[model samples]
Target: MNAASQSLSHSSLAYRPDVDGLRAVAIISVVLYHAFPFLLPGGFVGVDVFFVISGFLISSIIFKELEVGRFSFADFYRRRIRRIFPALILVLCVCYAIGWFTLMATDFKMLGKHLAGGMGFAQNIVLYREAGYFDTASELKPLLHLWSLGVEEQFYILFPVIAWGVWRWRGALLPVVLGLGVISFVAGVQKLPSNASAAFYVPQYRFWEILAGSLVAYWSVFHPVAVTRLRQCTALREALALLGFVLMGIALFVIHEARSFPGYWALLPVAGASLLIAAGAESRLNRVLLASRLMVWVGLISYPLYLWHWVVITYIRIIGADALTIVSGTVAIVLSVLLAFLTYRFVELPFRRARSSLPKTAILVSLGAMVAAVGMLSFIKSGLPFRPGLADKVKARETYAQYFENSLPEWAYFSRAGIFDAYRMECDFFDLESYRAGHKSEEPRARIDAGCYVPDTATKVMIWGDSHAQQFYYGLRQVLPDSVSILQVASSGCAANFPGRAQDGKAYCDRSNQFALEVIDKEQPAVLVIAQAYGHDSINSFVELARTARRAGVKRVIVVGPVPHYEPFLYQIVIRKHWNDTPRRIKDNLIQTFSELDERLERKYSDGAGGFEYLSAMRHFCNGEGCLIYLGDDRRTGLVTYDYGHLTPPASLDFAEQALGPRVMANLELQ
Candidate 1:
């Protein structure tokens, strides 16, 4: 083996230990941050470290090959494909199989979509549409880490070609790389706050970090600066390198979820990695630090570890595993290491090494096999069965088509775009059919529904809650008699008891809660409906609000639990269409959780106070087997929610009629 030719051996350049140590820093930061966010809020900067390392390493290889006039994009891409595709394909296959057993149809369909995106190296875009990085459901996505891989892959695809073109023209590589870095960096900074999803997922914003590493490679090749001045202060050079690592570590610990990521603050890790790399091969301390056996092993396994850890954590989180204790995290770490080792040994190393030696026909056959397998599995999990007596698959396809044709109402489009004076609240309010129906005339402004149940006397029925409350508006209007009028002011994602909301420069939740209280006191509504999703925030806060309502002469307070989500509705719809699955069988296990919350609320209000009543849809929504999933089974329109969780206008209206309307009328007679 040529010493200089091997990536990590004593090839043309002696192996740099500090770079491996930098990898150690990067991986550790990511592991710690995900495992324990409170301990090191900024540990996510490790991704920045990895980006620099990758850019430097890949650029170095290409530049060295070009210098020797042996550069081949084909060879480079082949290596990348062998290295990336084998393990990735294995993971996706296993994830898909596991999903069939454990995941709901909605979840399975989502996984299939993600698998398709991962295959095409566009998982980042898929994730951006699904949810924010910090969203509650994010941890449940088994392939979430593929977003970074997608970014890196995108960089690799474009970078080498760009470098080759520039080198061919005899252009100054360093200046060009620097210019690109500056532009990308500016874009990243500008997009971080207002468009965090774009900043996080888009390659344009991430190009700078990669450029930073590329610039280092360009400098190392064309203008190698000897460290003559550092002879007298060799110790100081070691100190500086150590400081760089320490600064990265500190930044990892200090950054947090509330803070925007990969903005200017990301410079810390990138600069730290760059400085340590620049500290050179002769520094004894730096060499020893990076060349430590432990560091080298971790670095060696970093890629596979990065891949496996996310899959494990996602499954664990989806199942509501134990919190990240030291033991659990240690177990996770060990499992990650073991999985990475097995994958590298059996899957990655073998495929990568053997690909070149395999016959062309054999290689093509293998590639074809992988593609066929992916297509087959995607179809199967999407409800397409090819077994004996499988006419059901065809029937399933038919059923799904009939379901969509029947359940979707003409008014649903109006609901999504904001029409008919529908009040819109929440970030995903637009995700609703009502919001898409053109109900919103302005951003962040909600329209109050003109009272279909306008009161005769000045009676107020305040709709106070989160997205669940919004879902009930149509239901209430239909069920509620003309004696009680509802003033619907609901916010999405904001529970009635949410202490405050910081977005839109408004405390909408607090304002709504307080407004409900004030309305109760002023108008003395015979009935008050309090409905919201039963997760996050303290429900005890609502106890206080309930207390305040009773003290303010309110006659009745009703707490409504959230509706059961019937699978991830849209995802299932798409997958069913694509894979010949019946949407009717899509079930949401969360129905039990929703029902339980109502039971808990009923227990809380069982005392004969006569003012507090907990209303539940347990009897109406669910059968003994499970909840009614596909809203009247292909003949119902505007019944099932638009998204996985929020209710549609028709369903909401129906629910209001069933639960709140009659109770309000009975109470009003007493008043």
Candidate 2:
């Protein structure tokens, strides 16, 4: 055997039951967080723990071979394939199969995109582009958890090459690795406040956690006696291990998604995991707790468990089931555990242990071809839209024709330009220069136009606020005469109030709203219309906006009240409750329940002290029976809103005619 092979021989490395136990802890924390976030709010820190463990173990093996000149990149890659591919591919295939039946065309298309990203080990980048970690939309994505795996895979790709180069140069591994970790940690912290999604998903910001483990591995290999001496100091080792446990416990119990993460806060879990690994199995805490048989067994199946849990939970959420309830969550947990065990036993073990008829290179090539084929098929076929029996109930409905006519392909509909198209502001708002510039700014400036509705005429009316304000534009155009010129200065998620963080925690909304107010002053349109989603805090801000508009020589200030909002997205509600049925009136009680916030806002605005006119959207949409989410018997008249709160173009037109047409015409002297 070569010296490198001798150093990496199985006898040279002892099995660490404590590491397996640590794996158990990490997997359990993640599973619980997915199933019941409230139960262990900081359980997501487990991914950080996993990152450290992976860095430690993988680096230890690589460093061993490097020290003795036995490291083969090809061999290392083959081992990675054997370890990661079996369970991951199996899970991906299963998720795709389930998604085929449960998801809508748009959702299925996203599934295809995510599947491709997962197969390519680029899910983190894909998800970063899609939405933030805590976005409601993210809950519906089955492959969202694969982002962490993507980060790890990316790390491994670069780590081995860099480490080998350092070893080849005969440089000290410890200081170089430690310096890299510190740099990564600092970069992550610096970026966390500005580009949180990048900080969370990008490998550079996350490498430190993994490198912390690599540092431990370096010490283990280079200073075995020192490690032994430290482990032998029973009192010191136990104290350190206990302290580490406390830090991790605090992370599991106290950390939450609301806080900026994987930055400075990540140190708690990463350090705790490193301390436990450094203490070794000899420590009382490691021996009694982490190295127990139960933990070891859990650790053994942790990979499959992690793979199975999120998809199940996400599917539950997709189907509109109560994913958080104890009963349903328990069922999901049980199902995940069962599926995990089967996958581990049948898929993982067999593929890992069985000798292949083909060479490792050929086997890897075949696997890569299979993965590529699956991804391509999913993407090109648009997740097999013609899948038999899928959406049969939806297709059977009379509204299906209209739904099909309006529904663009998922990818086309969600493109940056496409989403803005829903508001009919794509041409004006998404100019290439503006779009690129917006990304660089903390508060993206809104693109205001004098002639959205009538380019020939001067600006007669100004519309302001967030997306809610933008939804009224189509309606305003439809109801107003040709002579009326309207200018819309609205930003998504920005409310017309004093500058403050928006609900999405973006400062752009406030900055844009303030800028829009300045434009209204400069333009001095005949009428100023203000609309926003209802929030108690925004009431004062709306009042301020109205006063500012009136002071700016605006003839009128019309404050459009909040519309009824649904729990899940309106489209999801339609798909679940009404997709198979003929057009039916929405129930009054249901409308009342959904519009509870609107009603509260209405009451608050009833006082109307600011000399601003308050108009309730419920007045036009709701009747004695309920609200009109869809109009006409065939449900072809209008879709009230495409999503939970944003109006479709046709619905906006209808709303303009019914709610604001007469009021706006009177104010403009056009009727």
Candidate 3:
């Protein structure tokens, strides 16, 4: 150990306003990014910046405390509990209270599960297993930000022990720790492709970011000579500080969610934060740029600001407000600021102070009381905390029994293939482990009607793709004659490219594609009909798949567009239960968003080739301004989808009859 460095203690350390200023920059960028993603595509980098700042500040304090021989795990945990848990618990309480009044049973159920994850400090791992942050369906979960907190807590639990271990060993700990950080960074970079969620969420990959700050802390305390020598050149310090800010600004503007994140690209923000921290209070740029009184003030309340902004934006989106709109975004910020100020004044400051307004016993008791209150609220959400009648009323009643029994499969609703299940879904097709896990197929079933595959007499029409393609079965059965055959096979999560390595599970898709090619070569079927989900974003992949099919001797490939996925899942439940809000006459605002995807797709591939055709139900599904919801004469008997995207059996049948029947018959020359 460095004896001279051991002399420095927590008593000698002072709070750095400049660090708070850095925090202000991070929080504002994240808030702005979430509030208006287009304004700053890289605004999400703010979270990375905050992680670095957290590592630096916390490491500095820990180093100081350990040097003074006063470090205590109990004190550390108590401080953390006091600092983080109360406001989080408060937010959950208020959010659930709102859910009680406004949200439906299914949403409440989801919130309850997420609340449990949040309280347990494993939300990141939970969400990661569920498929990471950018999954379209994930935006609805309110506590998604808690994932970052989970990552931070994981760091907090492990880093102190490592630091203490190194201190006791009296060896080259700094170099050893830096080597560990380097290894983590390399591992993180390598793991980005297949397991992005793990790369994004797990501490192993993120440790380098935190350690970057820890390394700085080590330098400041044990290598003060370095800082002093660097500071002697004011111009160089100013230049480095300016470069740090610019780098952070570039990352916030240039980076995007579509790209893999927190990998090698993350070095920009970490290095930027490190530079600003290294320059410290002495650098003219940091003093003015980061430590400005306004910046310090915002930084002082940044934690609360971060907590409240997401909730505010989420509530706005839930109420059917445009999250990206200027007016709603402004309102969201105003509300977040107001709530943060209130929580900062009423909850954070008092709890953080050594001489709190409440007696220690009273404070601890209040925390217990608060926890009990939240527990009861959570139980209420689990199904009516104390009300037996309400519990029975809110339960998943038998009204949807027909939908469950005939309309939705247990596999459709709750299997790993189902929406609710999240296990064993991403295996490689050719891997023995994956084939055992069902990514591979044992055999290919012929998708022909009445076991007919006779030439000239029998023309088989095959359907291929994901669940979206699976949805076409109901529609196709209605249009095709009893004389001709129809074949359909789909698996969830498989893209058009069949895995050559893991061959078992993809047999369905491969056979369907192969069947179309064989029919073309054999000239048994008149038409080769194929359709898939195509959007502007998917145009390149869609074109490539279609080109491959065409080359395989398929006469034509069709592209189907995506359906609009709603935010709060209950909107459909309410519409189905009470009123008719069919896609034909959807709200104008929603139509605009739904149409955006279609318009972009149509523009890209409208003129591809004879190899491609666009089969659109847009005219039937939507009018010029909006789309229909259900397609029946009466409100009580219309057929649509049980959920937002998948079609109901009857509705799917009708859609097939209307859209693909003529094409299929013509393709087969069976009319």
Tell me each candidate's TM-score: 0.66, 0.84, 0.81
lDDT (Cα atoms) of all candidates against the true structure: 0.61, 0.72, 0.61
The most accurate candidate by TM-score is: 2
lDDT of 2 by residue, 1-671 (tens): 00111112243467888888988899899999988898999999998889888888888998888888899898888777767777777788888888777776656766887788887888888777654211345766788898988888888899999899889665567778999999999999988866677789988999999999899999998789999999899898998899889989999987898767977889999999999999888899899999999998888788888888999888887786223578878988999989988987897777666886867556655775676577667666655555677555654432332243222223233352234555655313323233332222344535444454334466478787767887888778778877777777676555666655544445666566666667677778788888876553344466666777888888888888777665455556666666656344565214344366667657777756666777888767776766666765545435565555666667777788877878888777731
The digit string of per-residue lDDT tens for model 3 on 544-569 reads: 65666666555556666665443333
Worst 10 residues of 2 by lDDT: 1-10
Pitting candidate 2 against candidate 3, the one with the higher lDDT is 2
Off by over 4 Å in 2: 1-12, 132-136, 169-171, 320-324, 388-422, 426-460, 480-484, 493-511, 525-527, 532-562, 582-605, 609-628, 658-671
Candidates ranked, most accurate by lDDT first = 2, 1, 3
lDDT of 3 at 531: 42
Winner on TM-score (1 vs 3)? 3
Q: Going through the candidates in order, what is the number of backbone clashes in each?
A: 35, 1, 28
**Relative to the unseen true structure, what is the Cα RMSD of model 3?**
6.7
